[model samples]
Target: MMNKSSQESRVETISEQLSLFALNLKLEQIPISVCAQAKLHMLDAIGIGIASSHYDFAKNILHALMSLQESNDQHYQVLGVPNKLSMRDAILVNGTYIHGLDFDDTHAAGVIHASSSAMAALLSVGQRHNINGQDGLVAYLVAIEVASRIASAANGGFHEKGFHPTGLVGIFGATVLVGRIMKLTAGELTNALGISLSMASGVMEFLEGGAWTKRMHPGWAASSAVTACAMAKNGFIGPRNTFEGRYGLFNSHIDSSNLASLEKCTNGLGQIWEMQNISLKPYPACHYNHAFVDAAVTLRQENAFEIDDIKSIKARISEKQVPVVCEPQASKRIPKNSYEAQFSIHFVIATSLIKGKFTLNELENDTIFDPQILALCQKIEYEIDPKSAFPEFYSGEIEIQLKSGKSLIHREQMNRGSSANPLAKHEVLEKFYSNVERVMSHTAAKKFTEDFLNLEHEKSFINIMNQLKVN
Candidate 1:
């Protein structure tokens, strides 16, 4: 058996290996497919960020956060907002906006919203430093890889322990992204992750009250990571065994940690790209509802059942998703607020069936509690699927019983926007146009879309940020 000291070394060595990958990975070495996917995920994040900025919670958070910033013309843009703030403040505000809708891309295997933190850091820092598109993508991939691997190693223990993996695990990735942009040496990058350990934190308590704190997790993580990197650059010292120390992440943040899997974090370093596993959302609800959204939409489209004809609706899903989306069934059936409705699998499926689509507008009070949607929600129920391959693939099945005694069922193993089943470019663009047009004139939205699609050709990040704002 390995001694306690040797175990600590093993963890530090893996952390260093991750640091080395971030320090050395090249833009050219990224696969063509991974690059395309990264760009798509990036575009999706930008679109979601701007759309979420229109929310009252996001607006209030932005206002509250900027007030804390010392006024200066350092000039970093917040998505969909015309004004600029200091670099750190901009990263925090925009990062919060990106995840406010809970619509950002996620790595299913790790149950982590990796892009929210990584993309926010990349955009705020990348724009400020005027980093090129390829370089930004490289940084994004590296950071997400490191964070997701660590999350995967934890084997869902973090969430069991009440930590939002996005915030807790994401700080590490955001730190690496900042380090990448700042050209930190491998040693410096290692120290950045080590320093970030002290700043990383987020709890699942937001679920209790439909609180807004969960929306702040990724943004806070991103901002904190930036601070960690800045400190590391100044030669700050941190515990070297940040991942496996007696009081480290796994031991402290995750319940009954998976040391065997955690030990394999560096196994495939540069070879098995984790970037490809990220999934984009088609609906604004919690990702646990994605497959059910598809099933509901299909039930609406394929069958002509009227409200009077439906008897009941039941969803079968991975047991692991119950705590997040289905449990508290009574509360989920009649959500207390819009934010609560977004996490309610019952509300999401009912609305999807009633309206034929689940969009950002579906969460409105008038829509969420529509008499028809509520009536349907009352009839809806969920059952756990013990065979579920959760944290690997999110899949679901919907069963409908008609008053006429006829039964209809729909099942989906691959969600609408997974790599195995992706939205067409035009579909993603349609999403972008819908989101951008909310804040910009039709002409400006179209123009900005074209320009952003060709962002790599632009010489300055200023041009990109300029287009992001309403003209």
Candidate 2:
């Protein structure tokens, strides 16, 4: 019933506030630690992306897009491939690689992988425009902040709506990041956001048993961001209240009743910096299963439970997590493919106990049907923890019953790599080297490490690309 003027008078609209923040945010205001973390995530995403470059699907998809490009003379590097591609093609391919493995960074409160889309968009656009490292870093941080806050505000509403927050809300953040890098006018940024509403989409049906669609979400979002910017610059106009209006994103895409969630999106803005809260993933699996991976490992190490000694293993997780990570419990216990196993809490717990670790190798096709792991997975059962504070903290509890009539328990309230207990630079470097080295040469890997660690001081993405794993 409210008219545009009345709506404006009602409250500062989401699009208006987000556009202003994206345009005017200063780099100096960012804390030194935040700037450092920004580099870490940017580097981390790139490492994971490079590792995925070897994937058959990654290779094929990039090749398919390359065939469609109008010209190949103007191009950007694809992480591991020798090929250089067009701006949009590079963005889509690189972003898809970063998320291909399901090991990218996650923001718990927003229940979204914040880095993949935003960082990919920034880096891809940075390459195209010759943006400096400092500006690129700022754009990455802004994308994370805006994306994470929006995810946090949505709370778990997107999941309830059967959507993947990364694919759903991720495009807006990427759009804002690209616009920032482009130095778009305030009106342009607003129109870009509005256009993003139509482009935003990612369903969570991949949870049925790890489909390829989830891997494509972030890449698609990055692509949408570039498309949105181009449309805005072409003088296209979009609805102002694309987020909170009658048919806005929140109303149409989510069923959330928490009006305060929207307020939380902009409440602290540059002040609190929600991007800092994003956690670098320790395990190459769903963030929901992270704490349990830790617990299962700890329980196995502490009690030294052998396969024959264990009668049953039980995990208590958030009920809302059941559909995505825990349930179709039977199918999860017997995942058909490597991708599906990563979403299987049963597989995560079983493999963690058996291997004392969960990493890229654990998700390998060879490990998918490991009889020992399957036996252990069969004994694993999950219970919904009513007290779980999910969408804020992804906690876990594990109890392993032994044949000797003894049970040992381990419960974790917070996963490691959260901002409260982030992975140290060395830890992140270790992970980066491990993933990148799989595809990068020893010499290029060493140089890439040094270049990435000192990224903010550099001027051109060309310097970074020079250290890529290209043939």
Model 2's alpha-carbon lDDT is 0.84
Kindly list the per-residue Cα lDDT of model 1 for residues 293-409, writing each as its tens digit. Answer: 899888888888797799988899988789999878888888888888988989988888888888888878899668888888999999987656676778889999999999999
What lDDT does candidate 2 reach at residue 330?
86
- Tell me the spans in candidate 2 whose CA falls farther than 4 Å from its real position: 1-11, 256-260
Q: For candidate 2, lDDT tens digit of each residue in 1-471?
A: 888666444436788888888888888988988888888888899989988998877988888887887874546778767887887778888888999998999998888997999977877788778887878888888888888888777768888879899988899899999999888977788899999999999998987756788888898899899999899988999888888889888888776564426786787888898878889988788889999999988987887657789999889998888888887988999999878898899999999888899988888877889999998899999998876767677888998999999999999887888876678888888888888886776677777778777777888976666667366
Total residue pair clashes for candidate 1 = 0
* Best model number under lDDT: 2
Identify the candidate with maximal TM-score.
2
What TM-score should be assigned to candidate 1? 0.94
lDDT agreement with native, every candidate = 0.83, 0.84
As a whole number from 0 to 100, the lDDT of residue 374 in candidate 2 is 92
